[model samples]
Target: MTIDHFFQAAKIEGFQSPYDTIHLKIFYPARMPSQVEINREILPVDLEKAPFPVVIFFNGFNCDAQQYQWLAVKLAEHGLVVILFNWIAEVMPGIISLTPGIDVEKRKPTIYRTVPTASALPALLAKVEQLQSEGILAGMLDLQRIILGGHSAGGRVAIENADPDFFPQIAASFGYGLHTMATLSLGYEADTILPLPDSLPLLLMGGTCDGIIANSCDRYGISPGNATTPVIRTFQEAITGGRNDSYLLLLEGANHFSINQPDSTLKTPLLDFPATQPQESFRLLMGEIINLFIDTHVRHQPEASQSLEQLLNTPNPLIKSFERK
Candidate 1:
């Protein structure tokens, strides 16, 4: 469908038009040391409310906090507060020398060379706590309802942070690739992959077309088909086995870049696929789907789940959705 058509459909579902009142602010807490210092951006909704559901986004390698600005704005418009972070340095100091042609800003070139997952988690958790304590996320911020997500390497970090046992087996099978791999191989200790704390809900999104980090199913070992399946299975296993509340969505023809704003400047060595789905349509559909999920899971809005069920079963070639068992 055309981008205009998609926007019209989104509006029909209560999706708000993109609003820029969404401000991104950085917070520095004096309690942490310089290296452990946190860089977080708070995107508040236009509505004047005390509390809002919170979504903390961990961006992929080479990507900065601004990469998901469009998404943050869209979600905020739906009454959700979105936060994105630059947990790792924007540019890896020396990875450019080893991996040429990789986009430093978008793809997170340095993340491929070192493992910063363990080091990054505490800062993220701290930021969440700080927001709660200071009332920056006061009434609007629903501590009981939180969604943690990321892309590519950031996805790996999120999973590892959520469950340490997550990658140990995979790491045993395939040595570290660049950054994350190198670090995992060094045998740094990490927190156990316990069920997501009751206070935090989990959402995992990744490109079905990512091939940079290859493994078992595909020859390169990094094919999306291989990477996504294991991650999804692991997440499902954790949630289902624990009977925890969680949700998962896999965009069929989407790649790593689909989740980020289409206008980002970073480019990677991977093939840039054609826009099988119009960018605006994809964004609108994604925004609406996410809203539905949060409304039902976070806010206890039953009607939102019914509407989302219709959207998921709509049989549109451009979009698809699934619920974890």
Candidate 2:
């Protein structure tokens, strides 16, 4: 678990559904890379210290992988092999332009229909197995430590699909099934009949002032913000159900778009809020805390355990409150 590692970037466009084309943007620790697409092109880095933990991150509705590059680089710096890909096909082009007649409610069912709740697990698992077998990523993947996560609609997908009992179709669909170590949902929750498997550790994170979706209040019954659907109920359900390993974080004065990157052209409605806190401040906070959380749960790093405890006890103004149960 070496924190001092430089990440090498690569873009491969093979992972896809039968009808859609999926592009996987990967970041891995490398001594050097033969070429750099976005940053710089360097020779291949020594991967003697390879087989890093995997994080399959799904982007929010209409958001693409490029939007989350900032967070991915930070995770890659800490010896994580991060994969960010476009899970849905239709949400694009429109998301970039904010065209007229764009409604989240109308778009959600499209997402539900296009994006399989559990198909991604087997698709990614097969892709990984193929890459490793061909020696392209021989020792660069740690499948056993995989974490499935996403934001907004993508987050809901992670939650709904992670239920092994509810969506057993994915297991039977593919020959090999994935055993995800944990699940992380950012600023969103699903309205699922089946709860997340008790064995799976879950992390629900959101902002108190998120005008898009209020996490501070029980907004399901009472409409207070732009979000018609609330996710706080999921947190309450997990906490009271005796899932001592689950956790929730509510960031103070942060909005729904705080963790997302602003498009230079399109005016995202979520970003229309007044800025009380610097955007990078939220990104740094999220990256650092998420890194520590993953380190504690995935790598079993004792230092992260101690640091998390210390940070949790020593309160800060940014974090309004947290429930670790």
Best by lDDT: 2
Q: What is the lDDT of residue 110 in candidate 1?
A: 39
Model 1: worst 10 consecutive residues (lDDT sum): 1-10
TM-score of 2: 0.71
Off by over 4 Å in 1: 1-49, 88-93, 96-118, 132-140, 159-201, 206-208, 211-245, 263-265, 269-272, 320-323
Kindly list the per-residue Cα lDDT of model 2 for residues 169-265, writing each as its tens digit. Answer: 2210100001111121222333331234444556667666565453323322343453212445556652243645466677776666677687666
lDDT of each: 0.45, 0.54
Predicted structure 2: lDDT: 0.54
Shift in Å, residue 163, candidate 1 = 7.0
**Model 1 reaches what TM-score against the true structure?**
0.59
Across 1-325, the per-residue lDDT of candidate 1 in tens digits comes to: 0000000000111112331011223321112223433442222223343365556555666666566666666666666556665432213443321111122222133342233233434444455556667643444455645554456555544444443232221110100111122222223233112233222344554434434432323322233335355445545554453333355665565654676664445555254444455656666777787777667666768899799778877787664445643
Q: Candidate 1 at 100: error in angstroms?
A: 21
Q: What's the lDDT of the predicted structure labeled candidate 1?
A: 0.45
RMSD to the true structure for each prediction, in A, is 13.6, 8.4
